[model samples]
Target: MSQKSFHVAVVGATGAVGQQMLNTLSEKNFPIGKLSLLASKRSAGQVITFNGESHTIQEATPEAFEGVDLALFSAGGSVSKQLAHEAVKRGAIVVDNTSAFRMDPNVPLVVPEVNEQDLLKHNGIIANPNCSTIQMVVALQPLHEKYSLKKVIVSTYQAVSGAGAKAVEELKEQSKAVLNDEPFEASIMPCASDKKHYQIAFNAVPQIDKFEENGYTFEELKMMNETKKIMHLQNLEIAATCVRLPVETGHSESLYAEFENGNPSVHEIREVLKSAPGVTLQDQPEEQIYPMPALAAGLPDVFVGRIRKDLDRDNAYHMWVVSDNLLKGAAYNSVQIAESLIKLNLL
Candidate 1:
């Protein structure tokens, strides 16, 4: 018997993460009976190649989801908020790669390695966690399962690509200008819509998104809140400090966690992570082997290293985690949720 296939539509097909979604789907050989590439009015009529065939992009509208069985969304929060339900109403299951629906009590925020079972409770829409949050939780889940988590504090070295393609271009332009001693105006880093933009080249910005009234930037809050939602640890003591780096891909984090139940040694924790799903253990201080954003770029697995026990607290530990921001962090994760839906017969 032939395997089942679905009509797959990729929203925001012209953007970076959206392009990554198409690449992942083709690379994974997903059973796609028909494909629809969608974007905004400005990006419509653009041609893209997929599965060795040239496809034209169309304007995304409620009516475009007429026969779509599965829709992967990565446009932006506003686009997802406007079109996700329309796609769902047209009988499509949406795996949204935006923050619009992540905190919705009805929509399940999913990281397959951590809380795939939540997919069973999804109501037409499944939200992918923030890029930084996804990598941290993938590393933390095994530890939490073994020792139970109490507190988590993460400091992120995020890639400029997290901002968008335009931000990435701005970084490159700024870097060249600085090298030539030329003056360049800042416009996209930190937050494009904000009043002030900072130079991202040869500098680190301690903000990722717009600052909230409580002083935490929106990106930091996403990491803190989304981790709790996905892990089902609503009361989990969590805090985040998000920083934008000059790198073009991959997100790196310094994680400090305190566990509740057991007193596991460093070797035991290393062994646990070594066998954990969707994780690659690279903790080898002797050879200076550790996870790095450069090494993790383009990979789907979360890379963990520099695991050690805290001197003051037996239940506390420190580690480093890294993964491609656009892959495991967004596109690959969204596709994995769709695959989980099929495997569990929930689609």
Candidate 2:
């Protein structure tokens, strides 16, 4: 680690992902000489304390970019699209946590363990993939490298927290209301502003984000599309079905993959996953052990378990993966990118 620190600015510091970014930065002891928190005018002047010091949030504008060496942005797409360039023009490198620039060819959609080298090629901004996509790629990247992943099909049971702080509170309130026989309203679970809102308490909603022209929800499409981009596999076959579940935190996935060469034994797969970067293998079928959302909450690394060979598919395997969607999926990954930038001298 470099003894010299950098000036860091965190945009959208009032939002969920942005708050996690700050926590991750402090916990990881990121090299910070100065810290700036930027948010909308609505949140400007609000104070956030860290390391026993208080820093006030400022309105995010072009002028706020002055003297900023690195900027982490998690505001909505509109805000990111509006101010990310301004931050860059003011000589700050941005790691954006919105979908605004993920698909832009010039901007690298990065997950450090998957593609740390991508940061070196960034044109001032790096896009962080969706939460679902980040954890999936981290687990899959190692397998993709070893087994030559021919295809990936994943179904995610995501937690309410992925929808932000509001949706989390909504779930808690709806649950209490349901338990007390009180009629609760649903206005935020599956696409907050969509025509219809459903109760997420004690229920599963199969839609996340809005449906796209291809009948896939935007969240699902992000996993499918962003995986290919970050992995640098233009021809990788991927499908995703992202769902919002009633869980408070963490995201779990059922994954099926077809390998190119041979059917690796269950033991081999476990060992490979154990050695993979940013992954923890928890498969122990005899003792009824596997990855689960409850155990994964607040953890930084992706958890993989239930490794087995597909019955009919000679080269296919099945597994379950879990992680704290807010940590490795969003905040920790962004912080890791900044670390990579420092290690590789990209910043």
Candidate 3:
């Protein structure tokens, strides 16, 4: 830890990802001169314990960022859109965890392992890539660099926690009801603001966010777009189908990728991932070992396994990727960006 500390503020302090940010900051021993917890007026004045000390949650207003050095935002997109610029105006570098400013030309969409240098281009606000995008890029970065990726097709099995706390509770309640053969009405599963919600306990919901005009769900589009931005592959062919599963924490994805020049052997791919930053290689078919959501929960590293060559295409490969959605996918990545800024002297 550095001896010089800075004042830090966390927006949406009561939410799942916000709380994880506080925990990550404490666990990583990030130097903190002062900490501010900001949330909506409804959650104001709440007490939260961090590093065995009590701090009161305050309302997230333009004035709340006064004297703050870094502001990590995980609130809804609307709150981020409203307050992020205000924080920047107050001289705070913001690592926003929502999609509000992701596609902005001036904002750097960052995944520290893949694009930490992108932080150097940040005007003030840095956009954290989508949770699913984060883990995929972390795994794909090494491969992309070595093999030169030509195309990517991903199918994600996302956890309920990505939908927020209410969705997690809904899964638990629905699971209990279903086991007891009781009737359960779902009010928030695939999308709360959408027309209908589906059961997420024993079933998988194909939709992650509202559908766009192109028939892709917003979540799927986010993965596709964010991948190109983070990897600096504007012309890369990418497609995603994001589905919500009964799992509570980790997010899993099955990826099919094609390289440009030559096909890399499974051992070569394993070697690339073994040395990749923020990635753990767990491929062992004989032992029946591979990355799984249950094993990846609570970890910061993206787990990659199930490496295999495509049967028909010599330039194609397949793999499985998993990560704790609330950690590496959100909180830990934001904190890592803050660390990257410090390392690169961008802060």
**Total clashing residue pairs per candidate?**
0, 0, 0
Winner by lDDT: 3
For model 2, residues 1-347, the per-residue Cα lDDT tens digits are 64989999999998888889999999999989999999999999999997779999999999999999999999889999999999999999999989999999999999998998888789999998899999888888888888898899999999998889999999999999999999989989888867899999999899999999989999989999999999998898899998889999999999999989777888888888899999998888889988898999888989999888999997898889899988998889989989989899877
Comparing candidate 1 with candidate 2, which one achieves the higher TM-score? 1
Could you tell me the lDDT of residue 22 within candidate 1? 95
Model 3 clash pairs are: none
User: Compared to the true structure, candidate 3 yields what TM-score?
Assistant: 0.99
List model 1 lDDT by residue over 166-237, tens digit each: 999999999999999999999888789898988899999998889999999999999998998999998999
If scored against the real structure, what TM-score would every candidate get? 0.99, 0.98, 0.99
User: What lDDT would each prediction earn against the true structure?
Assistant: 0.94, 0.91, 0.95
RMSD of each candidate? 0.7, 1.1, 0.9
lDDT of 2: 0.91
Report the CA-based lDDT of candidate 1 relative to the real structure: 0.94
Q: Name model 1 segments beyond 4 Å from true.
A: none
